[model samples]
Target: MPTDDLGGRGERIAAAYLTHQGLRVLDRNWRCRDGEVDIVAREGSALVFCEVKTRRATGFGHPVEAVTPAKQRRLRVLAQRWLAAHDEHAPDLRFDVVGVLVRQSGPAEVTHLRGAFT
Candidate 1:
């Protein structure tokens, strides 16, 4: 599969996983001139912004490691844009990273890191 397709599949899996974990998915693939946010969700009174990274193997490094400081900064800006474009509010804000590793056998491995950055 193409990298984009793999990433899309990972995003779908991550969304379902978050829903299963009781987070209401408010948005997916939300975009702006700045960038795109993979997922936006609500958990209790907190608003969550999530980034999903998918890889077929670990040779490049853990998928979560792909979320560098620069990416986090962009996500913060994107979050602000998302908030400005909508009326949703929350007492708390969180940034999460969902790393998906596709395997040739069995199910894909998912690792979720909550509050991954400030």
Candidate 2:
């Protein structure tokens, strides 16, 4: 599959997993002038911003490892932009990473890294 398609699939899987974990999904692929936030959800009083990274294998590195420091900073900025646009407030905020490994002959593996970054 194409990279974009793979990413979209990963986001769908991640959103489903998060919903099962009790977070209410508010948005997906939210974009601004700064960047895009893959998933936005409400976990009780906390606003959760998630970044989904999908890979066919771990040859280069684990998908979560792709979320570099710079990327984390960008996600934080994007989260603030998302909040401002909605005029929403949360008592707490969190950054999460959902790593998806899609195999050709087996079920995809998903790893949720809650509070992966500040």
Best by lDDT: 1
Model 2 C-alpha lDDT per residue in residues 63-101, reported as the tens digit of each score? 999999999999989998999899768999999999999
- For each candidate, what is the lDDT? 0.97, 0.93
lDDT string for model 1 (24-115, tens) is 99999999999999999999999999999999999999999999999999999999999999999999999999999999889999999999
In model 1, state the lDDT of residue 104. 81
lDDT of 1: 0.97
Range of the 10 consecutive residues with the lowest summed lDDT in candidate 1: 101-110
Off by over 4 Å in 1: none
Quote each prediction's TM-score: 0.99, 0.96
Pairs clashing in candidate 1? Answer: none
